[model samples]
Target: MKSVIFSFLLILALPLSMNGNDFKGIKRITANESQNESNSWINFVKLFELSEIPEKSLTQIACDSKYWLWINEKLVVFEGQLKRGPTPNDTYYDEVDIASYLKLGKNKIAILVWYFGKDGFSHKSSGQAGLVFKNDVLHINSDNTWLSRLNKAFEYTSRDYPNYRLSESNVRFDARKESFDWILLEDNLRGFGRAKVLGDAESSPWNKLVKRPIPLWKNSGLKEYKNKINFPFVSKGDTLILTLPYNAQITPYFKIRSDAGKVIDIRTDNYRIGNTLSVRAEYVTSSGLQEYESLGWMNGHQVRYYFPEGVEIMDVKYRETGYDTEFTGSFTCNDAFFNRLWDKALRTLYVTMRDTYMDCPDRERAQWWGDLVNESGEAFYALSPSAASLTQKGMLELINWQRSDGTIYSPVPGMYTSELPGQMLASIGYYGFWNYYMNTGDKETVEKVYNGVKKYLSVWETDEKGILVHREGDWYWGDWGTNIDKQGIFNAFYYLALKGFKNMSELLGYNGEVKKTQEKMDAFKKAFNAQLWKNGEYRSETYTGETDDRTQALAVVAGLADEAKFPEILQKLKTQKFASPYLEKYVLEALFIMGYEEYGLQRMKERYSEMINDPARTTLYELWNIGSGSVNHAWSGGGLTILSQYVCGVYPVEAAWKTIRIRPQMGSLTYAATENTTVNGKFSVEINKSNGKYRIHTLLPQESNAIVMIPVSYKKINLNNHLIWNGKEKRNQWSEYLGIDNGYHTFKIKSGNWNFVAE
Candidate 1:
C-alpha cells in the first residue's frame, strides 16, 4: 500500500479567505435613573424608526437586565435574566438572521439592559447583543449592566427571570421593587439602558454609544470598478501596470496568463491598520521591468500606475477591505516547549516504527515511515494541538496501565469497563508508530518498540473462519459507549496489523515468521472480503448483513475496496439517498478517495455552512445535533484533511518527492490561495489562482526527483525546464520521481501543465 506523506505546515497556508464582515465593535453603557434610561432607550428605538417593521431574521439581544429585541414592538429575542455572565449551558444565546424582518427604511430596535449582581454564570457578566447579516457581518452593542434592585430581585428568585421562574411558581412580591435602572451610553449608532450596584454611585444615564462608519461600498458616490483587464503577452524586460480605485486601504491582486491565469501577486500590506489607496508591482518579466521599477501609486480615489518598460499586463483588480481587532491570549513556556516536544515525539515514534518494521531498514526505511506518520498526525494535531497532545498522553497512559496478561483497560475511570483487544490495540499503536517513523525516519526508536509490538501481534492467530481469532472485539467501542460486533474499521486495522507483522518479520530477518505472517494476512484478507463484501459493495457487518453503515464508507476511504469495483461502489454510495448528520464525514471521505472531489467539496461546504449558521454552534462541533458533546473528536478534524487533499489537490506520490499534482475542483472560485503548507519535511507550497491559470510555488524539503503535471493546454512546463508528457492514452498518469534528500525544496508549476503529473 502506498502511503501519503502530509506535513503539518502544509495546511496552515490554505487560501480560503474568511468573510471579513463578521466582526463588530462593542460600546459600554451605564444606568442611573429610570427616566434618564428612558431617554437613552429612545436612541435604541431609533434603530427601528430607521427601518420598516417586522424584521424577517433573528436578532440577538443579550443584556444584564431585562432586555428584548423588538421588531415593531414585537419582541423577537427576550432574555430577562438579572445575572452576570454568559450562560454556561449552550442554549442561552440566540443568533437570529433578520433579513426578512426589515423594511426598506425606518426600523425600531429597543433594549432594556440592567445589572443584576456580580458577574456569575449567567448571561449578564459579559452582556452582549448583536445583529448578524446574511454575509455574517456582525454589529455588537453593550455587554453588561449592574442594577442593585435587579440583583435583589434575582436573589429573591433563583431563576434567570426576575419576575418569574417557569419551573417554579411563587413570584417574590419584592420583585416589583426592582425598579429598572437605565444607564445609557449615548453614541450616534444606538444606546440601551444600563444599571449600577448600590455601593457604587448611580452613573448618569447618557448616550455613549459609538456608531461604526458605514462601509465604503454603501456609498453611492464611490465609483464601482469591476472590469477585468488582461495583458496579451509577457516578454523579458517588459513591465505592465494598471490603475485601480484608491482608498485608505486597498486590496490589489493580479491574474497572470503564464500560469493559466494564476494569481501572481496580492498586496495585503497595511490592510489591518487602515485602508490605503496605493499601487504595488512585482516584475512580470526580468528584462523589461526591474523588481523595484514595477510600482504604482494611490492618489485618493484614483489609482495611477507605471510599469517598467517591456512588461505586458495580464489582468488587474482591486477591492476595499478592513481588518478585525487583534485578539490577545495567554502564552506560556509550555507553548514553545510543546512545539519542539511534538516534533520530538513524532521523531521518537518514527524511529520506533523503523527499527521494528518497514520495507527498507538501512536505506530510507525510517524516513519513509516517519514521513507518512508525521504527516497524518500533523494534520490532526494542527487543528487542535492541545487535544492531540492530550490524546497522545492518554494513549500512552493506557499503554503503561496494561495488565500483565496483555489486556489493556481504559485509563479514564468509568469510561470503559472491559479490557482492550490486546492484538487490536497493539496493531493500532504499531500503525501509529510506523506512521511516525515514516515521517521522520527514526530507526533507533523503531527498533526499541518493535519487539513489544511483534510479541503483541504474535499472540493471536487465524481461526477456522479465517478471522484473526482472540483479537479484542470492536476496539473503538462504537465511539458512543456501545460495543456491538467487531466493526469493519477494526477489521481493516487487523488487516493492516497483519501486513505490519509480515513487514516486521522480514525487516528483522525472521524469514520463517515472515512466511507464516504473509499466509495469515492472505487468509485474513480473503475471509474479510468474503464476509464483509456482498453484492459488489462492502458491508458493515456479517451478523445483520447490512452494507449501508458509515463504517463501510470508512473502509472505502481507507482503500479497502477492490480496485475494479471501486467506481461502481462509489456511485452506488453516492446515489443511496442516505443522509444522516452522523454519516456525512464518512461519506465525504469515501467520495474524496473515489475522486469525487466536486461532490466532496459541496458536502464539506454544506457542513461548514451549517456549522457557521447554527445558533447552537459558537465553535465547530464534533457532530451536528444538539446535546452532543463529542465536540473535540479527531474524526471531525478530517474535514481539514479532506480540504487539503481534495480541494487543494496536494497529494503525496512516493515516486515523486519534489512535485505535487494540482487538481483543483473548487467551483465558481474566481481566485484562491493557500499559505504555509509543508510537504516533505522542509518543503512548503503556496498556490494562487484566478481565471483558469494557477501559480504554484513550492519549497523543496530535500533533493529528490520532482514531477509536476499541468493541464494539457499549458505549454509553460517546457519554458520552466520541466518535463512535458502528452501521452493520449495515459494523460492522467503523469508522475514525478524525487531522488533522496530531506530538506526544504522548492518548485513552481502552472495549471496548463497539470496533465503532466496527473497520476
Candidate 2:
C-alpha cells in the first residue's frame, strides 16, 4: 500500500474575462430566408434596419458572411474568398475587434453574395451577413422586421464559422454566365435595401426591390414544432387528418391532441417530387398525449395522420413540410408532461454515447459502465424528487452486469478483447454509487453494491506491494497520450474504494475484513507518500523526476497526501499557477478539496463560462477541448460530481446520516441553486444561497438528524432541532465524528456580511 502524493499551488490572479457579456445582448440573425429561390442566392438586406449607430468602438463581430463589413464606407472586417459551406477547420464566426473602425452617426454596411446552391452545395447560393456592434444592440422579433430576418444558418453551415460558404462546386459551367450575385445594403440614415444579380440578365435580374418576403419557411410557421402537438380540443378515438400542400415534394409535419388536451398523435407525410403523400391515422385511449410520425403522399391537398394504439385524437398542426419548401399547415398540439427539447437533447446524448461505444470494440464492457455511469448520474441530477430511485435502479443494473471475477467489462460486446485495466470503469462506477448512496443515505444500495465493488478492487491488488496495479493498455488516453504507471489518481480512487469498503463492512458487522482493509489502507498511504513525494512536491512517478502533472495534483487534492505536507502542497499549487485552462478540470477539483477555494472557484467560473459560451454549451464534454471526439466525454461530466461536492460544499459525511454540510463560496453570483439532489432512500435536497444567506430544504423519507457546516460570523443559525456556534465548539463536533457515522441531523448557517479567507 503506497500513498499517492502530489503538490498544490496557490493561484492569486483575478479571473480573466475571456469575452465580455456583450455578445449575449446581440440578436441572432439567420441566413436561410424563404424569399430566395430554393438553392439560390438569398438577399438578406431587407431583413434589418441600421439606426442610431453607436460612436463607441466595436469589440467583436461574429457572423457567417463571405463578405466585408463597411462602417461609413470604411472596410472594417473582410473575410476574403468565401469557401463553400463550413470547413471542418474554420473558426465559426469572425470574432473581430472593430473598436477602432466604427463611426458615430449614420454608417453604411454593404454585402455582396453569390447564389451557387444551397448549404450542401460546394459553391452555389450566397447572401448571408450579420453585424456585431458595441453599444446599441439589434432586436429581432416574431414580426417581420428588418432585424427579424431568420435563417437556418447552423443547419447548413458550420456552427464555428457562420459565414463560410458551404455550397461550393465546379460544374464545368461558364462562370460569367452561370454565377449570380447577392447584395445587401444597410444605411443608418436610410434604413436598408437588397438586390440579386443573375449571370443571365434575362433570368429575372434584380432592380430596386422593396423589402423581401419574410422567410416564413424556417422559423415562422410552428411556434413549437419540436414539441408534441398542442391541441385546443379533441374527441376520443377520432382519426385526425393533417394536410400540408406544396408545389413540389414535401413532408407534412403535424401533432395530434385529444379533446381532453392530451397529445394523441403526430404524423409526417414524406412525398417525392410531383407526388402527394398522406399518413394513415389511428387513435388510442390514453390519459396523456401521444406522438407519432407517418410517411405518405400529399399533393398540397389531403394528407392522412397516424396515432398510437391507445391515444385519442385531440388536435394537430403542420410543423414544416419540407427542408426546401414553404408549405404551411395549421393545427394545435396537446400539452405534453415532459419537455420535448430536453428529452430530445438527452436522446441525442444517448445515441452519441451508444455510437461511440460501438466504435471501440475492445472496451465494450468498460464503455458500458462508462455510459451507465454518466447516464445514471445525469438522470439523477435531471429528474427532481425522483433522482434517488432512478440512481438506485441504474446502480443495480451495473451491479448485475458485474463479472464473477470482480472485473466489469466495457459495455459494448466483444470490446477490449485483451485484459486491460477494467478497474478504471469499476472505480468510476463505485464512486458514482457511493456518491448517490451518501447523498440519499440508502444503506440497502450500499450493502448491495459493496461486495461486488470490493471483489473488483481485490482482484487488482498486487502481492508485491499490496497495491492495486492496472496494466499499461488499460490506461485512459488523456492529455498528450501520457502513459500511467500506478498513477496517482488511480491510487487515490483505490483509497476511496477501500474507505467505502471499510464503512460498509462496519455497518454489516464484518469486523475482520474492515480491520484488514484499514491496515492495508494505512500501509498503502505510508508507502504512497514516501515513494511519490519529493522536494516539497509530488512527483508524477516514483521512477521519473517529473514533478508536476495533473495526476499528481489530483492525488494531493483527493486527500491521498500526508496531512503534514498539505501546507507545502498548497504553496506549490499557487506557484505553479494551477488556474491555467490547459490544466485538467479534475485537477481543479483536487485543488478545491485541498482548500484552495479562491483558486478553484476562479477556475470553475472560467471553465463553466467557457462551456456556456460554446455552441454546444453542454454539462459534459469528451475532454475539455471541443470536437475532440464524436461524443461528449463522460469523465468531464464526472468533474461536476466533484464540483457539487466540494465547491458547493455539499459534503455527505457518513457520520451524520441525515445531515449535509454546506460551505458555499459563490463569488459575485447573486443567486445560485441546485435541486433534486437525492441523498438516502427516496430523499432529496434542494439548496439555495443568496446575499450571504443559505437555505437547505429537505425532502426526506424519514425524520433524521443532519450535521451542517455553515459560514462563520452569522447572525443566527438553524437546524431542524439544533443550533451550534462556530469556532472551537464546532471544531470539537467535527473531530468527534470526523470519520464516524452519526444519525440524521440538519444544520444551517446564516452570515450577516461577506468575508474573505486568506491563504
Candidate 3:
C-alpha cells in the first residue's frame, strides 16, 4: 500500500525537486461514480477509525475542489484554497499535525469534498479528480468504499462584469435536500453508495497524489473588524446595508430561522454603485437551526444586502474576516496625513495578502507579477520577518509555472493567462528576482529558477533593435489611458529585464552573460533615445507625437535617460496628466530619482489626502478618486515603500542589506523616524529639525555597512559637530539645490547608531 503512493514519486517530477522533501505514504482515492462527473455534484464522505493514536500523528491531504475534515467534528484551517484549485501537483497539499486534535479511543474522520468538475476561468482542471489523506498510523483515501450521494443544492453559475473573474456558484441550498449529518459518528447513511475510485494508476501522471515536499503557502487571513454596522432592516425589512469602517476582506454568513420553502436574495454590496456578489438561498427546513452558509467571499468598504419582499422574519448574524498577522513596522510624524496614509498603506497590502499576493480580494484573487514586485517593496520592511516567506513563495510559484515555449504566465496559476504580453513579464525577471535576492539573500532560489526565468525572457528578445516587439499572442495593459503608446512602457521594462540578467550574471559569476546582456541593454537605451525622446520627454506613442505619465515614468525610473536629461525629463514628466495607484509607484520612484523630494511627498499627500479622512480609509485605494478598483490593491501601498526607503533613507544597495544605503530626502518634512526589518536584521533612522539645526540619528543593522546621505542646502556640516561630511558647491541632480546643487552630503559608516547635526 505504501509502495502504491511511492512508486512514481520515486521516479521524478519537474516541480518536486524544488520543494526539498519527498512524497508521503498515501493512496489517491475517489468515488467510482459515472463518467459524467459534472452532471452529478457530489460530496464524498469517508468514515475512518483509528484503534489508537500515535504520539506523532500527523495528517495531510489534498483534494480537487474543497474539503472540510471533521476529526470528531473539529474543523481544520477553517476551509482553505481548495475551491480555487491551483493546477494540483505535489506542491498544493495541506499538512496539519493532528496530535492534539486526536483522542486515544476510536476517533472518527469525515470529509465533505466539493468538486466544480467543470472547465472555467479559475479552475481549469487536469481532469483526474480525487482525494488523498496520509498519516503514519491510519489512512482514509478517497475510494469506492467512501459514501457518496449527489449534492443537489449547488449549481455552478457564471456572472458578468464586476464579479466576472469570480469563480462563483449559485447556492439554492435546500436543507431538506441535504442528507443527515453523515459527518457525525451516529448519523445514518441509509442509501449512500461507495465512491468510485480515481487517480489510481501509476502510468498516468494526473491520476496520482504525492506528498507536499514544501510547506503550504502562507495564509494571512482576514482583518479584524473595526465596528460592524447592521443595516436598520437586517431582520425587519427586505433591504439592508452594512457599512464597514473601511475596505476589508470579508466572508458573509447568515444565521436564520425562517419558515420552510421561503426564498431569500442576498447581496454582498450595493448593486448600482459598487461591486456585489449575488447569493440566492431557498430554505427547506422550518427553523430548528439552519445557516445560509458563506457565499464566495466579498470585499468592500461599504456593502449592501437584500432579503427580498414577502419573506418571513428571522434572526441573522454577520461575521468578519479574521486577522492572520500583526504588522510590525511603524511610520508616523508631525504630519497627520502621512501618518494616516502610512497606516492605511500597510492595511492595503495585508488585506489582499494571503497565501499568494492576490491582486485584489475582489474579482481576481490571482497573483499579478508586478503587483507582487511592488507588494514586497513595502511588505519586506513592514510585516514580520516571517512574512518574507510569501514573497519567496510567490517568486518560486511563478517560476514553477514556466510554459514549454519559455513563457511564464503573467498573472500566474490562472486559466486566462493565455495572452498576457511580454512587457507583463518584466517584474518576474527584474523586480521579482532582485527583490527576493536582495531582501533575503536566498541564492538557492536564484540558482534553481534563474535559467527558467531567462528562458521566459528569451521569448521577447529580438535581433533588429535588441528590444522586443509585440509578436504573436501578446496583451498590453499600460495603465488606464487612451493616448499613451504602451510600447514605450514595454521598452522600459525590457531595459529592466536586461539589467536583471546582468545583475544575475554578476551574482552567479557568469561574466560573459553579464557583458552580453549589458551590451544589449546599452543598445536598447540608445535605440530608445533615437526613437522615443522628443522635446525633452520620451514620446509615448511611436508616431502619435503624444506623451503620458507611465511612458516617461517607467523610462526615467529604468534609467533609459542619461543623468544630463533628468532635470529636463522630470519637468516634462510631472506635467503629463493621469495616475493610477499601480502606475504611481513607478512615478514616485522616478520623482525621488531626480531629487524632487518635496514635490514627491506633496504629490503623495495630494493624491491620498482625501482617502485619509471623511471616511478615514483603512487601506490605500485602487484609484485616486476611490470606488474605482479594489479598495486594497497591492500596488496602492507604494506610499509606505517610498517613505521607508527614500524619505527615511534606508535601503540596500547590494544583495541583502550587507551594504545599507541612506539618502534622506526631507524636502518639507521637519522630522521623521522609521523602524523596519530585513533579512540581515532590524534597522531604523530618525531626523529632526530644530530652529536652524538639523539632527540626524541612524541605527544600522549590526553587521552591515551604512551609506548615509544628508540634505544640506547651505551648510558648514558637522557629524556630532566634528565635520564628517561637507557639502560641495557643485550641483548634482540628486540635490534639492536651495541655491546650491551639492546640498546633500553622503557618508559610509559601520554598524551601530550614529548622530549628526548639520546647519
lDDT at residue 162 of model 1 (Cα atoms): 15
Regions of candidate 1 where Cα sits further than 4 Å from its true position: 1-398, 409-431, 459-461, 468-476, 480-486, 500-516, 575-587, 606-609, 615-618, 651-682, 687-695, 702-759
How many residue-pair clashes does candidate 2 contain? 107
| Distance from true location, Cα of 335 in model 3, Å | 2.4
Model 3 per-residue lDDT tens digits across residues 546-657: 5677777788778887778878867765676465777787788788887888888888877777666746457765677666465567777888888888888777887667
* Model 1 residue 599 distance off true place after TM-score fit, in angstroms: 2.1
RMSD of 2: 25.8
Model 3 misplaced stretches (Cα beyond 4 Å): 1-25, 32-52, 81-91, 118-122, 139-145, 153-164, 201-234, 270-285, 302-325, 462-473, 609-617, 626-628, 700-702, 712-744, 749-756
C-alpha lDDT values of all predictions: 0.35, 0.38, 0.62
Error of 1 at 617 (Å): 4.3
Per-residue alpha-carbon lDDT of candidate 2 for residues 646-691, written as tens digits (9 for 90 to 100) = 4444554552135545454443332333333233323333445556
Q: For each candidate, what TM-score against the reference?
A: 0.42, 0.46, 0.84
Ranking by lDDT: 3, 2, 1
RMSD (Å) per prediction: 23.7, 25.8, 6.4
Worst 10 residues of 2 by lDDT: 4-13
lDDT of 1 by residue, 608-649 (tens): 554445432222333554333322122233454444444444
Q: Which candidate gets the maximum lDDT versus the true structure?
A: 3
| Candidate 1 worst ten-residue window by lDDT | 210-219
